[model samples]
Target: METLRHIVLFVHLIGFAVLFGAWAVQAFGGKREFTRLMSIGMSIAAVAGLVLAAPWGLPDGAEMNYAKIGTKLVILLVIGALLGIGTARQKRGEKIAPAVFWLVGILTATNAGIAAIW
Candidate 1:
């Protein structure tokens, strides 16, 4: 069970990397468009993160950090919303606001920081 948890954790990190990596590339490349890779990465991260939030593999009497988990979950949802809104706007022939595009990257990094620091 512990090994399984580790595996899931690895996948969760991979997902984070994918999402952030895609965002970084686009941001640095001067493109504001959303890609399928970003959505794929977010989906992977969200699913793996949800799995990690469970208590299945925890040691006896050890509890999960609900507050941290909740915070990260909310951030993930916000990122998802941003992605959806930005993609929709792109599809509608409207330019995605720079703030919206930048927020996605900022939030993604913030989520990773929280996971690491807290």
Candidate 2:
């Protein structure tokens, strides 16, 4: 179980990289698929991480830093929204602003760092 936790943590970090890299690519004029995959992958990875970091032995809420976790959740949600918007626009062949991608990417990546460190 201890090893599993560490593995999950590592995967969580990889997920963050994938999420950030995909978003950054889109922000820098990459394809919409990158943004789509990032959003979906990040969301799934987060859920898996939470499951792996389960309530084993620790009292409820004791191991959690809710403030940071909440911030991370919010940022992730915002990224999800951006992904949705990008999808809708892409369906119509519209070009989304790079600034939007940059904002979402930077914010989400920062949130991931905060969750890991803070």
Candidate 3:
């Protein structure tokens, strides 16, 4: 069970990497549009994160940090929303606001920071 937990945690980090890597490529490569890869990465991260939030493999008497989990969940949801909105708008020949594009990257980094620090 502990090994499984570690595997899931590795996957969670990979998801973050994929999401951020895709965003970085677009943001710095002269294009600021959403891609399917971003959505896929988000899904991976969200699912793995939810799994980690559970207490399945934890040792006895170890309490889960609900507050931190909740905070990260909320941030993830916001990132999802932004991705959806930006993608939809882009598909309709609309230009996504610079703020919206930048926020996605900012929030992604923030989420990783929270996971690492808290």
Candidate 4:
């Protein structure tokens, strides 16, 4: 069980990497649209995080931090939704503002910040 938890944690980190890379490519490479990978990776990370909090991974007497977990979950949901919508809009031949992409990056970074510091 412990080993499985670690594996999930690793996958969670990989998801983060994919998201980060996606943003980097757009921000630096001058792309105006998000790839499907960005939304997919964000989802993978969010799900893995929840999996990490499964009861089997906790100490025998430890209680999960529901507040923090809930906050992160909500933030991730927003990120995923925003990216998904943005991608869809772009696919329809509509131009999405660069600021929207930047906002996604900001929200994602905020999620990372909260996760690391909280």
Error of 4 at 82 (Å): 0.7
* Rank list by TM-score: 3, 1, 4, 2
Location of the lowest summed lDDT over 10 successive residues in candidate 1: 27-36
Clashes of 3: 0
lDDT values for all models: 0.95, 0.70, 0.95, 0.83
Error of 1 at 65 (Å): 0.3
Candidate 3 Cα misplacement greater than 4 A, ranges: none
Give the Å shift of residue 97 in candidate 3: 0.7
What CA RMSD would candidate 2 show? 3.1
Pairs of residues at least 3 apart in sequence or in different chains that clash in candidate 2:
none
lDDT: worst 10-residue window of model 3: 30-39
Model 4 spans with C-alpha error above 4 angstroms: none
Query: What is residue 116's positional error in candidate 4, in angstroms?
Result: 1.2
On a 0 to 1 TM-score scale, where does candidate 1 land against the true structure? 0.96
Candidate 4 is scored at a TM of: 0.90
Question: Against the true structure, what is every candidate's RMSD?
Answer: 0.9, 3.1, 0.8, 1.4
lDDT of 4 by residue, 1-118 (tens): 7688889989998888899788878788866588878877897898899887677766578887788888888888888878878888988988777778888888888888887898
User: Model 1, residue 32: displacement in angstroms?
Assistant: 1.8
C-alpha positional error of residue 62 in candidate 3 after TM-score superposition, expressed in Å: 2.1
The true-versus-predicted C-alpha distance at residue 85 of model 4, in Å, is 1.4
